[model samples]
Target: MEDSYRHKGMRRQLVKVVRSKGIKDERVLDAIGKIPRHFFFENALVEHAYQDKAFPIGAGQTISQPYTVAFQTELLNVKPGDKVLEIGTGSGYQSIVLLELGAEVYTIEYQKELYERTRFALPEMGYKANFFFGDGSLGLPRFAPYDKIIVTAGAPTVPDALIDQLKVNGCLVIPVGNAKTQQMLRLTRLEGNKLRKEVFHDFKFVPLLGDDGWKK
Candidate 1:
């Protein structure tokens, strides 16, 4: 069918653009290529889903741009079968990407509406990210000791609680800065009570809402 060919072409184009823009991980690329982003959007935006742009999914959150999703996944250092905790379930796109990378994910989101939307969509998409409704910035204490963690929403700063929940040597990738702007931050756990911070370029995302994030 012509429609199927067009969908495949769009998928290939998305991967080409994302890689040219510096998405280096093959696993990340493959994951991005496979997921049907349109299914995560309102039907009106289905045609635009593969355009590599973020779209407003109700409840004050936007599905992150495709490249950013790939970037965060690569930075989180996901390994096959790693236990990954993702904060901010947002349109469930990022959670789907994590599942593609073979990570066992646990995700939390605050807005009740967005939480339920994602929960309903996950099983239908054949994804298995354990969904939780709560203040995401607190991080899921029940799923501590994760091999890697990622926060889809931007925070004012990294939370101490998240740092405590990581397994020693685990990696956490987050966006941290003032509400208006953000910088990508990578934290890797070192030996006993030690953490290494790596700061990358500036980016913007929806406010990470919780005690460790913006004033909410």
Candidate 2:
């Protein structure tokens, strides 16, 4: 519960690990250092919180590995005051990182349990985000045209709805592939609704569930 000196030290080591893994964004690494990842885990798993690995956070979702979080965030190229729509809240760790970078985050969670838990937990940790519960694949049309969109789950393909919600010149980061593993993709929305796609490393994530995602 407490972010002690030891926890801060652990986070510094994590930053180094993430940096070694090629996350060169200083802002992203700094945000990772400030957020207390252990706060998202139970007491039993707290010891391993700073490790660069995913841990289950109930509802069949896992807190994403720190490296993956940094990787996706760096690809987003988030700017201060950017309107970022996150497709999966999960443990809310990714949202917190974005908030630390001065982003106006609006995050959607699919599982009711995880959503309810994070809806209260994040603010308690001094992080604020607009939280919604529903099918993230549908995207949040009410608040469309986001400057950045990040999907935290693995999808069979990029959802068209997400691309539609992005503003011109906006960026989207997602993992696309089968249920087992996914290829990280960054899409920059160009003029005329065209997208510039770039593929990065591969990662494993929970299935993105919804009509536009993997079928239930």
Candidate 3:
């Protein structure tokens, strides 16, 4: 549970691995180095925390792999004080990264257990984010028009509500595809409700579930 020197050293090595994999953003690399990923796992699995792979975080959800996290975050192009809406809080790892990068994050989780668990866990680690439990696909309308939005789970298609919630100049990063694999997409809202879309490489993620996502 303790973040000792050895754990910090391991995180440094993990940062190096992520860097070598072409995560050129220095701020993203630094956040990866600073966050104690081990703190998010059970003590028995803590040794594997620094690995680039994903691990089960209870509730059938897995914390995303490090490279995927870096890649998605880099695509987000986060800036300090940006109001970011994150779908799928999961282990709260990604939210912590955004918070570390000076973002004001509002995150939602569909699974009640995961939401409750992460809601408390994050603040305990000195990280803070507005946490909510609901259908993430609907987007948080109360806090709509976010400066940036990131969806952590894979959706069959980008939710229309998410696009509607984005600010005119805001960006949305999501993974879209079928159950098996997804293509990463970045959507930038332009004038006249138009959006500029860009596609990145493929990734695998748990299916996004909600009214706008996969049916229960």
Candidate 4:
């Protein structure tokens, strides 16, 4: 809960590292620099918080590496007041980043433990977002037509439900491939509801669990 001067300094360095990795969005970099990444880590793992690495949180999930978070956020192209749906909330670090970028975030998690923990923990740290517990790969249809969507876990394929929930011209950023390696993909919902897909770098993530994802 405490972010010291040293932590701020470390986050600055982490932002620089993310920038060097080709994350060109200054808004994303600013959010990375401003948030205290260590707050998402256990006391014992605080030393690894700003090292541009993913660390296990619990329930076989991870607080994504800073670079990965920044990469996805940049691809999301969040605009102020944009409605964003976040899948696999995990440690809630990425939600905080979207909030910092002035997005209205609706985040869902598949694990009950992580959902409950982050729901309480984030607001305690003065960050707020709509939190939901369910199968995130199915998408939060109750609040469909989001301006942007981000999936933090790897899926065997893009979930049709998520694409269906995006507003026309909305963007969905997700990793699609196998359980161990996924190619990051950005799918934009075009005017006719057709999708324009762009593939990016490969990454490894915990499998996204739900009906539309890997079987739990």
TM-score of 4: 0.98
lDDT of 4 by residue, 1-216 (tens): 788999998888888899998989888899999998888877888789999999988899989999999999999999999999999999999999999999999999999999999999999989999999999999999888899999999999999999999999999999999977999999999988889999999999999999999987
Instruction: Decide which is better by TM-score, 1 or 2.
Output: 2
User: Between 1 and 4, whose lDDT is larger?
Assistant: 4
- TM-scores of all candidate predictions against the true structure: 0.96, 0.98, 0.99, 0.98
lDDT tens digits, residues 73-178, model 1?
Answer: 8888788899999999989899999889888989999889999988988898777779999988889887688889899888977898899999999999999888
Which digits, one per residue and each the tens of the lDDT, describe model 2 over residues 1-216? 699999999999999999998999999999999999998877787789999999888888899999999999999999999999999999999999999999999999999999999999998998899999999999999999899999999999999999999999999999999989999999999999888999999899999999999978
Arrange candidates by lDDT, descending. Answer: 3, 2, 4, 1
Model 3: worst 10 consecutive residues (lDDT sum): 39-48
Give the number of the best model, judged by lDDT: 3
* Clashes per candidate, residues 3 or more apart or on different chains: 0, 0, 0, 0
Winner on TM-score (1 vs 3): 3
RMSD from true fold, candidate 3: 0.7
Candidate 1 global Cα RMSD: 1.8
In the range 1-216, model 3's lDDT, one tens digit per residue, is 488999999999999999999999999999999999998887888889999999888887999999999999999999999999999999999999999999999999999999999999999999899999999999999988899999999999899999999999999999999999999999999999999999999999998999999988
